[model samples]
Target: MGAFTRPFFIGFRRINTYSLHSMRQFVLFIVLITGLVTGKSAYAQWEFYGAGGVRYATTEEIDTNGKPLVKEHGFLPGLEFKANYRRGDWLVTLGGEIYGGNLVYDGQTQSGTTFSTDTRTRQFRMTTEVGRYVSDAVLLLAGTEWDYWKRDILGRGTTLGMEEEYNSWRFLAGAQTRVLQASWSDIYLTGLLVVSSPEHLEVNFDNQVFDQANLSTKAAIGARFALEVRPKAYSNVSVESDFEWMRIGRSGDAILSKGGSPVGTVAQPEHVRKAIGIKIKYRF
Candidate 1:
């Protein structure tokens, strides 16, 4: 497998430590804000919901030369939960989801060697947002989201596999509108623009635990869209379909290390992910 199997691992122990701390702080801040907002009015309206769905996700990594190096795609079952509080024209919402499955992996090396395997994948996402109803049918929102993903490629004969982990934070601004309303049903549409920062990736080769590489932080932009339908008959039930797309720019080169000693330089290629899902939710 040549370089593809040559134990390319990225070490991010210190960085991950700092990131975890920051993430905790952010979560705490969100909780504090939520408490403050909701405490103002004992009569604030509250809604809670849980959802289950299946998602199809595809991820691709490109080479420095802009050629595709690896592709992984799969369907995963997932669950989501959310809580919303509304007072007057203001809204506060917190939500999260977890999903994972085995993905079919296809990869090709620069020297034309090819391989196929299965990759175990897991992902989690959390979001907090505040919004205001601008009109009877329109709402504007701003939010922050944290995303985490991990993949473990199974080794094949004479070939080594590796594990990759990624973390990122995103800021989003969006608007939602009730597109259609009737006595029996309502349909809503939402669109969001997202900006991501401090993208981090860590890699570990199964065979060479001592070798590592670091990908420099890069910013990315993405978008999300959702369409939701609520049936009057059920009153508190809704179904939603959503799509998300993101691209992480190619990272700058960093020193590769073996046993804490610098060996050479390596850079992470551009990465892209796309996902679509349908979910049914029940609210109380």
Candidate 2:
């Protein structure tokens, strides 16, 4: 009886040892998998950029009769900042810009009266985008943007100053690709198709009797193009040039209000804007 009991205890000990060894191997496998996942996640990084540049912008508005009403053109100084986060094949970007300056305004009233003035202009823009890398050199992008613009027409002699404000939203789809690769520098090109909608315009007459008017415009399609160059020695610096064009359709007539009473009807005419800009950017 003692021999049989001793052999039974020995068998139990051997089985316990085998179970411990297998459990250790399983724990080791789990640790290795967790480390690999953590290492892959650690590869995600953020990049920031700041830029200053000059933009040349031009805008033209036509009346309902297809007669030109006003044209404004100027060179505006601007500053922009951007941030990007990249993880594996996905990228996210956010950016904003502001531009302000005095512009030359030429206008002709319905009575064939022509006048010119210096208009104080300011523009603000915000953008967000998501991109996916399809290849080493190509990326596809989708984005949305918000834009605000204001113009203050300075009074000339007896005329009173007037103020105009515009708000617009846009959705965009784009593609970017590396066009040239060299030892010192690389060049990239991008093109975007944009759709603008839910645009609003407000006009203040600066008169006690007339007050203000608000109008909503039709949607439009636009496009943007950009070219960028980066130097290998200065990986954190780049130069970019871009062009954009957009048109806003005519708005339905709206009632102009004075106090609590309706004074008259006002409508925003069709307008087109074009801009070209260049900037040097520093990234970190």
lDDT of 2 by residue, 77-148 (tens): 988877677889999987777788998878754345566777788787778899999998999999999877
Model 1 TM: 0.85
Question: Candidate 1: how large is its RMSD?
Answer: 4.3
Query: What C-alpha lDDT does candidate 2 achieve relative to the native structure?
Result: 0.75
Error of 2 at 62 (Å): 1.4
Which window of ten consecutive residues has the lowest lDDT sum in model 1? 7-16
TM for every model, in the order presented, reads: 0.85, 0.82
Give the distance in Å from residue 145's predicted Cα in candidate 1 to where it truly belongs.
0.7
Candidate 2 runs further than 4 Å off: 1-44
